[model samples]
Target: MQETQDPVITSVKPKSRFPKSVPYIIGNEAAERFSFYGMRSVLTLFLVNQFFNPTDNPALTDQANAHANKLHHLFVMVAYALPFVGGMIADWFTGKYKLILYVSIIYCIGHVMLATFDGGLSGFELGLLVVAIGAGGIKSCVSANVGDQFDATNQDLLSKVYGWFYFSINAGSMISTVAIPWTYEHFGPKWAFGIPGILMALATIIFFSGRKKYVKVPPQGVNRNNLVFITWYALTHGSQRKKGEAFLDVAKQNFDPERVEGVKAVYRVMMVFFFALAFWAVWDQCLSEWTLYAEKMDRVVNVGFAKFTIYPGQLSTFNTIFLLMFIPLFNYVIYPWFDKRGIKTTPLRRLGTGLVLTALSFVIIGVIHTSLDHGGSPSIWWQVLAFLVLSAAEVLVSITGLEYAYTHSPKSMKSTMTGIWFLVVSFGNLITAVVNGLIEGGGWWATALKGANYEWFFVGFILVFVVIFFIVSPRMKERNYITDPVIDGEVAANTNSL
Candidate 1:
């Protein structure tokens, strides 16, 4: 018999234009991010101003801020952590498309709870929890869904698509970061929260409209390829290992070799994500501690053409705005410039360089904090400069991370690997929450972290992680796994299956 060919595979020529479904995905992402970031932009302020009573005492104000910071970070921790669950469901049960659609309705409902219960603390907390669950549930699926749209034929566009995906995220974030805070200030919490709810509904509609265009990969269902079972089997069956055999390699005795190798790839990628925890710990502070610091600074800006005061929450817009600028700059001018000079700007190099920049951003924040501690009002321009550095780091670490996680992942475990990447951010926020709890407990560590020392301590903390990343990263081998086009109803071969 003549060999059969998949029509989808043959239709796509090499180096073809972006997949047809890309615009819809990009649109959905932009609207979804606007909703998420809009609600988040005003969260800290809402907690401090509305949920808690205003206090005249400086000490009481400080306590409220610390408490708000703890709640904020904890909320973030839960949001990032639940992606693991989302990823599993996508891989084993519903697949990416169905799960994202179902969970996004829950996301819209969470926003409703926030808008309706703006006055009560308990209700607000409930709303936040629901929103976190909804947000986290769809997180891994949406990103991985973007990757599923392409196969071997146009795999070269993966990096560029991811870049545009990230760009849309920042573009939505930049607009919401400015607009939501202004809404909160003028029309109050109900309107501000409600606006994001509206945007999220639009996001859901946008995603659904593209259903026919998407390359829908069916869920794999429960299988021996499950990483958890493979690891357990490996641990229990270790005695069966032959001489000079590696640990995970022992699993090959029972499981398919490809499945076992996928598990090993997960382990290697996770090791890189481990060092990323410090970066996230420092990065998320831009929302909480940094916003509080902005409250104490002179926010007035007198431009040659206009004059206005920037709200504390609005300061976050600078990071998003800078990201909009930096993503293209790095992709076009900077990376190309380095390539021409015989310098390779690899993903690991970008991640390591980002870590160093994260530390430097904090160093700048530490100086401003020192000036504030002395009762000197610093320019908001100083905070802007710090955000500039931090935004550059975000481009290197976060955008690159999305591409790294997708590419390094095995064909069978893409969503799971992406979930693990988000888990790194969850752990980073956990560290921040722990530090805040310690400070609230009033201990020696608290004293060390007091006032300007807080920023300095984080600076030292991130620098140490940066050094550790540089030392360990070069040792990690790279694996690029691209899914071959669909054959009949099944995904075809995967390049570099091992």
Candidate 2:
């Protein structure tokens, strides 16, 4: 058999040097997020106003809210679920760059359909299906691609790079989310939808321009046993697995040393991923219930000098604003402070804190709703407090999750692990979907949420989930592998020794 040639290593690059493609990737992410959040921020209100048919009292049109709510969650589910296929296909068949490029074109078509058919249900549904194809397909690959650009050499930048990468995302989202609804209100849905489509095109163009500079990882197809199969192998075959055995420890008797280490790391990450479900479930309320809450509240803005009325949907942009501020503070100030104080401040630990903050945000909203139930009209700034808390949690759980997904997974399973990470979010949206269903049906919980007692749902149930995950988070292990892998020869030598 012929030997595969070694990849040529060039001279040492300076630490200050960032990847040539990084600016483009960051630009693409920002624009893509703008495309997504712009439409999403207004979707519920839009559906209730134009698309969904109402059967409730002509005055209280919440009769059709159930349909709109169901469809909204279904859209979220489809968007997150397809990543399973996209990530798996990328791992074995298409690789990240090609798959993203192909799906992005479809994404643009979805947006065009929205621009063309905002008044019709069928066209919107079709457009959503197309957008889901592109959005879900790209989710797993784009973040993983960011990690691909780094190696042992420039590993120092991963944390900050991810921070800024996330910042760019929310920056675009903040701008478009604040602007799109106004566009929809005045310029019309055609322009509102069309603007996002244009941004998606720009995102695609920027990404394509950087293709030559991207660190393209070759796809390892179905023939390889990825982390999922390895986990299965450990669970099914290893009876002598001991306590504190990093789940991959079960593989010591069956696999090589390198494979064993990889599985152990993957296992630890999966454990954290499971607990993360609560955070996402609670966090995504910004898309649904928060908008609903905003509609019921006052939105007259009087900022010191200038005053203008704003749409309730524009309130969602607060998250983007908070995220931009918090990510840097966490990256430069918070995490560093922890490390300086002899605390490891691991990803799981951060995730646990994020959940607490999310629960707190809900508590604030619940109280505000209670006040509204009393017929006292408070300023919209109350919701701003909630968004600030939630966005802080986003910086904690989300950006940390990005770093953890890349550094913790085995090289071969990185893309798949990324997909599974988002699958956790789908599960979160599923939680909201179930709640929406329960609310649609007449129930004690629904009655409480409906008639001004909504405070208990956040302060009671969601907070309980936060406490549960906090207890479990400490049990999940953290393997901080910031540096890249050793040479293949070194890995093979270690395997031989094992």
Candidate 3:
């Protein structure tokens, strides 16, 4: 095997203030998220009102609801699943910077197709496919890029930066969630979709402006020590393994020890993502299932000074609003409070607690749905309460998951690991889509979980996974990997530490 050459490195010095490139990345993410969520905020309503069933018939309405829900989740699944492919490409062919810059252009084209092509479902579905590919291709690269900016010299700031990164995402989401729905309602699909396309274009430009400043980690070209080849060799050549050795250890006889260990690290990170699958299955429903529920409830609000109506799509803004509040609260107050008392808030602990909170949020939704089924006109505030709980869970699970994925994986496979994390989200959405289809098809489970029972069934589904997460979380080992700064054209020793 040939020696792997280290790429030219540009990074901050020891104990330096925040990296200068951070603001550009954060700004780009804010605009990109605005574009993506803006389009998604109105997707189900657009599909139902224009494409799926444009009739007033009650039976068709019911069918449209089910179809819209399934399609929405299916789109999310495809968007998320493609990240694995994108991550592989980024890790093997194009570096993160190039991959993100080029695919963003494709992402903009997808939005253009949605805005300009008013022909029918064929064009619209094609646009969705393009968007999914473009979006997924850049997903893992963008997040992994955040971690690429730091090394051991300034690794303590990683968690704080991740928190602010999440804050930027929700800030974008908060604006678009409210703005895009109103645009869809008053302006029409063309303008509603077109506006987000413009935002995508802006996001691209913002990213490009930082071209000279970023720490560009060059791609690792195809190597014999790739995880896939090692895993396959281990599986196929098991006869060489010693008794009582771990499965991957069999490959160590023929491969570099460090490379083999990196494969094991990848496996460990994937195990965590396996349990996170159910969390996302329930979490992504905020835009689809929860919005649909909001449509049925009373939406009027009285604030003494004024009265206004909250649209179903706008109801999602509460999640964003709470996210903006909770991120700072948790980072500044809650986590610090825990630290002062000698309590450690580990990533797995945050994730487990988040799953329980997610379950509690669904319970609130189930109660509201039950009231609606029994002819009780409940206020929309009940749904807002649910969003409050769900948003807290998101802060814990989603943000920490990003930090965890970046920190746990080897430098060679950071994007690949992050992509796998997203693949878990894809599977979660797939579960939701499949369940919606099954329920709509009227099977035994569907009959038993009809009406408000549907929400309760999901609550139980999530709780089962929550229990599994806790049971397995304690047994998993944790590792933190940070990049080693280059010195005088020579790479320093490895800085991987527990």
Highest TM-score scorer:
1
Report the lDDT tens digits of candidate 2 across residue range 1-498. Answer: 999999998986675667888998999999999998888877777777776543334334433555567667777888898888888788789898999999999999999998888888999989978887888989878887898898887789888788789778778888998899888888867888889999999999999999999999888877445666666778886677887765566766766666666666666677768767777776766776677667768888998999987777788888777776787798899999999998867776787788778778888888877777687776789999999998998888887887788876667556666777778888877877777677666657456557444445645666676677766655544545555445652221111000
Superior by TM-score: candidate 1 or candidate 3: 1
Per-residue lDDT tens digits of candidate 1, residues 163-277?
Answer: 8997899789988999998998899999999999999999999999999999999998977667888999989998998899878888888888777777877887787787788
Task: Give the Cα error of residue 413 in candidate 3, in Å.
Answer: 4.4
- Score residue 270 of candidate 1 by CA lDDT: 80
Give stretches of model 2 more than 4 Å off.
Answer: 1-24, 53-63, 146-164, 209-217, 232-257, 334-349, 403-414, 443-445, 451-455, 473-479, 482-498
Q: lDDT rank, highest first?
A: 1, 3, 2
Could you tell me the lDDT of residue 148 within candidate 1?
Answer: 92
Candidate 3: minimum summed lDDT over ten consecutive residues — where? Answer: 489-498
Q: Estimate each model's TM-score.
A: 0.86, 0.81, 0.85
Query: lDDT per residue, candidate 3, 43-67, as tens digits?
Result: 8888887876777555565456667
Q: Model 1 scores what on Cα lDDT?
A: 0.85
